[model samples]
Target chain A: MPNGLDKPETTLEKIERMDRRIVFLAIAITIILPLIWPLGLPIGVSPQVDDFHEAIESIPDGSVVLFPNDYDPASKAELYPMTVAILHHFFKEDRNLKVIGLGLFPAGPPLLQKAFEEVAVDQYGAEYGKDFVNLGYKEGREIVMASMGESIPQTFPTDFFGTSIDSLPIMQGIKNYSDIAILVNVSAGYPGTKEWVQQVVSVFDVLMVSGTTGVSAPEYYPYYNSGQLAGMLEGLKGAAEYETLIEEQGIATSGMDAQSLGHLVIILFIIAGNVLFILNKRNKNRDRGGRF
Target chain B: MWELLGIWIQVFLTLAIFSFLYRDNPFYKFAEHLFVGVATGYWVVLQIRNVLIPNLFQPLFGEFSDPWLVIPLFLGLVLFMRLSDKYSYMSRWGMAAVVGIFSGLAIFGFGGGDLIIQIRSNVMPFIDTEAVQAFTQKAGVITFLNILSNPIFIIGVICVLFYFFFSTEHTGALGVVSKIGIYLLMISFGASYGNTVMARISLFIDRAQFGIVNWIPTVIIGILMIIAFVVLAITGKVDPKKQF
Candidate 1:
């Protein structure tokens, strides 16, 4: 009897023995290489992202917009760019944004602040407290949302900075959803885009838009189709599309080349992975006297 | 110069992180650890500022102060009590409070928002427009199918509810309907899984684009990663099946 390790390797053995880390590595390289030296692949704006832009653009200047940063660092890769692009549009158009954090994920507030500061808000003379106020993370997700729908000031007495909401110029007249022009929900998971739409938007009938991970996008499509959500930005592709739109208006087009290349590399890896699996499977089955 | 330097640092960090795609190695490990450390540090600071201070502390001292803050603060303190072996049982109170609050919130939210509204929305007529409604009414086939589907929808709801019944044995027509209900549930889950896979694949694609851009330094980093993979493979330091 031969030891298990010393036994002659079969095709099935090789197939089964294939390393998943290698696949991860392949995927990593495929993504990174493109980011570094982008192929500058052409990307078209999806209607979802386009509609989201149109909705925001239609909102009058100085209009109070409820902007929820309903995500964390885990989803930063996808949502961050979208956040920047949207903030550019809002700030450029001179719209007042009331940023809210629904997620208890502590990283949500500063991430939004950093993105806003980096993405043209500084140049556009966007001031905090006057132009925007971070409401921070409110405890009791759905309860707080319901409370917010009833009364914004009662739910969040102060902004994230511990400053009184009553003192903020932007938040002065904003009592509820009725007061806001539109809702821009950038969400990752639970207590996110869906929660806002269901708990607040549905009853208030507020015009709402969203930017969510690709995973969450399809679930929101029914709402979009139903006209409950005016528009949506779906994942990084949606972010890139929105970025492209912004850049065309001369905001952040340079980044799109990088974004497009990154997407292309990933598509290539998926193709490579599927090809390898098919090849490996065929070889194994042939050896096993099974038809491919 | 500093701004350009910051951009380069970002580019390097991005490259370092992406190096993991080729293989698990020291470079990837270093980057991963650095990210985890920085992220955790950032989170801890934010939690202190946002959740711990405002929700937990200010409520204790601020004008609208409440004694109830003590209850949550005590419960939260009990969570740290878990670090001590002798006081591990104390942590259960905190856990219970959290679980209870979350469960109550889920039921309340889901009942009012998801369950009621989804059903209401689906059952409601699609077209309120007179032209569309008149056309649909004139189309006898549409009216017949719509009428036939009403009972089917009711039957589906009953069957699905019955499928969850534990105390009683499903029998006769109920048993058949329950089985069909299980199949439908499974199909729904499978479709959800398919959608999730598609989303994850899109995410992976986004990451890959970072590495493949025309920048010279980035192209060099990509080459280095490949070389490192080959070196590790040649040295037999990594067993692909086990490591991956």
Candidate 2:
């Protein structure tokens, strides 16, 4: 193997010799720097995101929305922004909400509270048991989801902080999906948006919207096109775009600049990586008698 | 004072998790473990209050008590048998119940929502008056191509479904159609991959900005990291060839 300052190294030599730490550092910088000093780039809202916005927007005030936060902290980086944006839209539109969680992950309950509290502070003088209720996490994902759509209180008798559902103004007349206007699911993986669509939405004839991780987005496109899901927020980019729309409406727009620039920096890094890879391949092929 | 302390704890914990970007170390491990522990504890408490108490216990003992609750309660308890080797097989009943319920729900859901409804939605548009009216209005070179291509939509759907039909051999005209379907599927998959890469890269960019722009102190940390690597290399603590 040739050392640095010697003849160009073989691909195998580079792989064997390159420091793993360098790759780690590159990834770290690629993620962190843009977050700190954002470029505030423009992001066009996709039709999917717009559909999500319109679904929630079209629901009348005082209508019930069953929101399931089915993700943990690991996914917070991507899903949190979407949660905030959606909640802001919900609150701004004055919709009554019933929050439930399928105990897929432990962090889900508290994360839901934190996100709601962050957005609900300034809008509508929102009172806890009256405007919304957190039914907390339930076991048995499919069974619970199916039962809840049939009977809300049968699934959750009490709220998260130990309040009876009967006492909450929000639960007064909301019997099932028939009373509820829409089902908003902010999910990470299994027993998530897909499960909700299958077990609850399809059976009950409820409107459904989902915000899912990037990896899961493609799988859901068929459902989206079929009208099973009225709208979808696709990963962080979708979240960021949704955030932009919310902020433009004069809600939590303060963070848009930071989010936009972060996206631009990532796009630049991908371009740089591909360019370097192609150049290196060409140089190696030329030296190796035209063999790629 | 408590609020300030909480803020500090959160910030430090966030930084500790982020420190894994430099290298895997004790701080990162500690944060990871703590996160898992706290998260698990939170879920257990929530389940007791919302699920176990209300759905199972309340119905078993409270006003609306029913014998049906006992069945699920027993099954739920049997899941604990998983902890003992002798009783491990008992847990399968609970597992089978959950799997059976999920599978039934998934099949019904997919058939009603995805398969039937999707095909209906796509085909319904073609039969509508709007489509025919547009075809009639534009009856020229462009419109002729559009009208002629209408059948291709149904053909494309059939071809794509046929391409996945491993049970049958491709022969005659079906072979060419299936080949086209395979090409379309590949292009769609490639585009999806590009979207996924873009999403992951955005996450990477966000983290990079945090390390560099959040604090100037990271510069010194960066320098220390480089120096440590160089020293390890010089002192033979790390083999140059095995750096990865």
Evaluate candidate 1 and give its CAPRI docking class based on DockQ.
Answer: acceptable
Candidate 2, superposed: residue stretches over 4 Å from native: A2-38, A93-105, A246-292, B1-23, B58-67, B81-92, B122-159, B167-179, B201-244
Give the chain B TM-score for each candidate: 0.64, 0.65
Model 1 quality (TM-score): 0.70
Supply the global lDDT for candidate 2. 0.70
Task: Give lDDT tens digits, candidate 2, residues B1-244.
Answer: 8975564465556666766655565557788999889867877777677667777777788856677878887888899999999999999998899888888877887786666777776674444465567778876775665565546666677779889887778877778879988887897797678667655654544444444444444455556555765787698775545531
Candidate 1: tens digits of C-alpha lDDT, residues B21-107: 544677778878888999889767766766567666677777557667788789889999889999999999999998987777667
lDDT for each residue of candidate 1 in A1-292, tens digit (9 for 90 to 100): 1215434766544644566665565545554554455566677887777899899888776678788888886677677778888887777654555544334446677788777667645667777777776787765666777777889886777677778778887777778878888889898887787777777777677889999887777788767755678899887677778878877332123345544444465567567667767876776567667989
> Each prediction's Cα lDDT score?
0.69, 0.70
RMSD for each of the candidates: 6.4, 5.0
User: Least lDDT summed over 10 consecutive residues: which range in candidate 1 chain A?
Assistant: A248-257
